[model samples]
Target: MAEFTVNATRFDPYKNFKFRVKWDGKYVAGISKVTSLKRTTEVVKHRHGGDPSTSRKSPGRTEFEAVTLSRGVTHDVEFERWANKVWNYGSGLGAETSLKDFRKDIIIEVYNEAGQLAQAYKVFRCWVSEFESLPELDANANAVAIQTIKLENEGWERDYSVAEPTEPSFVEP
Candidate 1:
């Protein structure tokens, strides 16, 4: 495990645009957007018989929010293939779902301005819950065709192995 180090020179936070999503040890191509990672814990309230009105609260189950990834429609079928693993249409009655390898662990990496990997997260047991292969098309409208996939993951954790990077510096004479 890499020890955490603070980069005092880096005043500005990392830009959201410089990030990448990878699965199966390979980075997915052309991923334009990724929803924020979030988790919520259920609050459980309990009150004793003699206790006053207010109930004591405690944390219960925690759920990881679904993450949506969007990109311009292209020849790349990584999103479509993962979505199909959950439910494939026209693939016959008993063969609709690929149970053996449906879920995948994915990595989301954020890079600093100098293109150095600054942070990384490991999302576990993710399976596509929804997929949109193509947006509505119109001859009069001009826009890139976008596709999307919503992934439901069991949990995620920050990869502490990725230490803080040393920001690059330029010298001026």
Candidate 2:
């Protein structure tokens, strides 16, 4: 004889491809790939002469990796305009200044099978840091043109206020 075990709660799986990206309160298009949505923190250590063998470790500064957004080149010049908001040449045409109206926060959402928000990554004070220049073209070749832009953000955090994606379970066709 054998006993079966199963949790009463249901679960749903989410795919990475099914994600939505929003910036400056607007949805951006032409995106093909995303990378480096990870963060790291520094640690500090302290110890006393009479203390135990180990030292005390405390969390220090947190650093967020620069996010890279890859996409195919398009007719839209939104990316360049977005970068100008961060630091653009002054109208005087010499010095560069930050545009008060340009900087904005970004949010990326992942959706589950039910089309529900699974996870959200909120990037604070995000700005376009770098965008690759136009790529070279050949006389005879068959391929899609693609470009990648990198973003430098002050900080980012997973909105734990939101629930995690549902767990995977049996589903009927």
> Highest TM-score among the candidates is held by which one?
1
109-171 in candidate 2: lDDT tens per residue? 887766778778899877777877466677797877877668888898777666654556668
TM-score of 1: 0.95
lDDT winner: 1
Task: Please report how far candidate 1 places residue 88 from its true position, in Å.
Answer: 1.4
Off by over 4 Å in 2: 1-13, 87-91, 136-141, 160-173
- Candidate 1: residue pairs that collide: none
After superposition, candidate 1 runs with Cα above 4 Å error:
none
How displaced is residue 155 in candidate 1, in Å? 0.7
Lowest lDDT 10-residue stretch of candidate 2: 1-10
Q: Tell me how candidate 2 scores on lDDT.
A: 0.74
